[model samples]
Target: MITLNSISKYYETEAGVVSALVNINLSIGESEFISIMGQSGSGKSTLMNIIGCVDRPSKGQYLIDNIDVGTLSDSNRSRLRGKLFGFVFQSYNLLPRLSAIEQVELPLLYQQIDNRKERAIQALISMGLSDRIHHTPNQLSGGEQQRVAIARSLVVNPKIILADEPTGALDTKTGLEVMRIFNELVQKQGISVIIITHESNIAEQTNRIIRISDGKIIEDTDKIVKVKA
Candidate 1:
C-alpha cells in the first residue's frame, strides 16, 4: 500500500548539508506488521516521519495507494495524512488537562465527525480502558497512558499506524503488553503497523524486521536470498 523509491532526506545544518536518510527504497503492504531497527541517529525516525507524511524527502518519491505524496499540495497532504495514518509515540503526547475520552475525541474534532463522544468511548473500551476513560494522563499508569495514546490513534480508523519508540518508557511486561496490542491491531483490525525501535526482542515480534544503519537499509528480513555458485 506504500512505496518509497530511492528516498533520501537531507538537512541544511549550520556546518553543511547533512544526510539523514540515503536512498531508502521500501514497500509496505496492507496490514503488515513491520519494525525498523537502528541505533540512535541512524535515520530510522527520519524514515518514519517521511512515511507518515510529517516530513518531506529531499529527493525521490513516496507513493501511497498510487498517489504521489510529493506532488500534493500542503492542504491536500494534510488531508491525506489524516485520512491514511495514525501516530503513536514513546511519550504519550496527551494533554495534561484532557481526560482519556477527551484525548481520543480531539482527532475527531478536526474531521467534524458525528457522535464523537461515542466513538471515543468505543475506542477506549476497545483498548480495555473503559473504566479509565475519565482519568487524565497523570492518573493513568505508564501502560494505561500508552493505551490512551493508541486509542487516540485508532479513533481516526487509520489504515497505517506509525509508532516511534512506542515501548521505550515502559517496563518489560508493559512493553510486551503494548506489543500484543499492536499485534492484535494487525491481525484483527487489518491495520498496517510500522514501528521504529532499537530493541531486537521487540522487533522480532513483528512479521518483518528491517535494520538501518547510517541512513541506509542494511538488512531486510523479508527479502529472499539467492544461492550463488
Candidate 2:
C-alpha cells in the first residue's frame, strides 16, 4: 500500500548539507506490521515522515496506495493524510486543555461530520479510554495518555498508522502495552502500522523489519520473532 523509490531527504546543516534518507527504495503492504530500526542519526524518522505525508521528499517518487503523493496539492495531501494515515509519536501530542473526547474529535471538526461528540466518545471507548473520557492529558498516566493519542489517530479511520518511537518515553511494561495496541490495530483493524524504533526486541513482533543507517536502507526482510503477550 506504500511505495518509495530512491527517496532522499536532505537539510542544510551549519557544517554542510546532510542527507537524512539516501536513495531509499521500499514497499510496504496493507495490513502489515513493520518496524524501522536504526541509531539516532539514522533516517528512520525521516522515512516515516515521508511515508506518513507529514513531510515531503527532497527527491524520488512516493506512491502511497498507488497515489503519487508528490503530485498532490496541499489540500489533497492533507486529505490523503487524513484519509489514509494515522500518526503516533514519541510524545503523546494531546492538547493540554482538551479532554480525551475533544482531542479525538478535533480532526473531524474540519470534515463536517455529524454527531461529532458521540463519535469521539465512541472512538475513545473503543480504545479502552472510556473511563478517562473527561480527563485532560495531565490527569492521565503515561499509558493512558498514549492510548488517548492512539484513539485520536484511529478515530480518523486511516488506512495506515505511522508511529515514531512510540515506546521511547515509557517503561518496558508500558511500552509493551502500547505495542499490544499496535498489534491489535494491525491484526484486527487491518491497518498497516509502521513504527520507528531502536530495539530488536520491539522489532521482533512485527511481520517485517527495515533497518536504516546513515540515511541508507541496509536491511529489509521478514524476521521470525515470538510475541509473548
Candidate 3:
C-alpha cells in the first residue's frame, strides 16, 4: 500500500549539511504490522514523517496506492494525510483542556464529517473508554490517555496508522495492552500499522522489523539477513 524509492532526507545546519535518511527503499503491504527500529539519529522517525505526509522528502519518490506523494500540493498533501493516515505519538498529543470525546471529534470536524459526536463516542467506546469520554487528559492515567489518542486516530478510519514510540510512556503491561489494540486493528479491521520503537520486544511483536542506522537500512528481518554498513 506504500512504497519508498531511493528516499534521502538532509538538513542544513550551522555546522554543515547533515543527512537524516539515505536511500531508504521499502514497501509495506496492506494490513501489515511493521516496526522501524533504531537508536537515536537513526532516521526512523524521519522516515515515518515522510510516510505520514507530515514532511516532504528531499530526494527520491514516495507513492501511496500508486500515487506519487511528491507531486501533491501542500493542501493536497494535507487532504491525503487525513484520508489515508492516522497518527499516534508517545506523548499522546491530546489537548489538555478537551475531554476524551472532544479530542476524538477534532479530526472528523476537520474532515467536515457529519455526526462527529456519535463517531467520536463510538471510537472511544471501541477503545474501552466509554466511561471516560467526559474526562480530560489530566484526569486519565498514562494508559488511558494513550487509548484516547488511539481512539482519536481511529475516528478518522484511516487506512494506515503511523505511530511513533506509541508505548514509550507506559509500563510493560500497559504497553502490551496498547499492542493488543493495534493487533486487533490489523487482524480484525484490516488496517495497516507502522510503528517506530526502540524496544526490541515491541518490535518482535510486529510481523516485520526493519532496523536503521546512520540514516540507512542496516537490517530487514522480514526479507533478508542483517545488512552490514
Candidate 4:
C-alpha cells in the first residue's frame, strides 16, 4: 500500500552533494514480504527511512494508500507514521534499565493507548517471550532481546514493519528463527514486512527480493517480463 516515484535523497557534505538514493521507484502491496539487499553505502537504509517517514526525500513523491506524504504537516506525518509503520533495527534499541515488558509498553505509552500493560504482554507472548517478560535487555539472550524488539514493534498494530538488518546481531539459527516469525506475520497477521539485509539467504526467505547498488535498484524479482518466442 505504498508507492515511491522517482525518489532521490541527497546530502550536502563538505565534499559536495552525495546521493543516498537515486531514482527509486517501487510499489509495495498489502501482506507482502519483501527484502531489499545491498552492501554498505548502497542506500537500502535510506530507502527504509524514507518509506517509514523517518526522513523525506530531497526529490520525488511518496504516497501511502493514495495520500501524498509530502503534503502533510509535521504533526500529521508523525501521526500517519505511527499509525502505519513500526520499526526494528539490528541494535535492538532497548533501554538498558527497562524490562522486556516495559520496553514493549513504550510505544503504546507514547500513543497513550489504553490497557498498555495487557497489550504489551500479549505482544511479547505472541513473540514467544512469555517467560522472559520481566527480564531486562542485559538479562536476555540476543535472540530473546531481538524478539522483545519485534514485540515492541507489534504492539502498535502497524500495517508495515521496516526492519533494518534485524537479524544482523543474532547467530545463524536465531536469524532463521527471526525470519520465520516475520513470515508468520505476513501469512497470519497480513502485515507488510520490508526488511533491509545484506544476506542473500535472508532475502531468499521473503516472497520478493529487490537488489540495489550505488543508490539505485538493479534487480526486482517481483517484476514480470514476457519474452516472445
Q: Highest lDDT: which candidate?
A: 3
Clashes of each: 0, 0, 0, 0
Better of 2 and 4 by lDDT: 4
Error of 2 at 206 (Å): 1.2
lDDT of 1 by residue, 31-145 (tens): 8999999999999999999999999999999999999999999888888888788999999898999999999998899777889999999999999999999999999999999
Which stretch of 10 consecutive residues in model 1 shows the poorest summed lDDT?
A: 220-229
Provide the lDDT at 180 for model 2.
92
* Candidate 2 residue-wise lDDT, 52-156, digit = tens: 888999999999768899999989898888878888889998889998889989887866678889888988888788899999999999889888888888887
TM-score of each prediction: 0.96, 0.94, 0.97, 0.96
Q: Where does model 4 exceed 4 Å of error?
A: 225-229
lDDT of 4 by residue, 1-229 (tens): 8999999999999999999999999999989999999998999999999999989999999999999999998888888888789888999999999999999999888787999999999999999999999999999999999999999989999999999999999999999999999999999999999999999989989998999999999998888421221
Worst 10 residues of 2 by lDDT: 220-229
Per-residue lDDT of candidate 3, residues 1-229 (tens digit): 8999999999999999999999999998888899999998889999999999999999999999999999999999999998889999999999999999999999898889999999999999999998999999999999999999999999999999999999999999999999999999999989999999999999999988999999999988767642432
**Candidates sorted by lDDT, descending order?**
3, 1, 4, 2
Look at candidate 2 and tell me the lDDT of residue 108: 79
In candidate 4, how many Å is residue 53 off? 0.3
lDDT of 4 at 220: 86
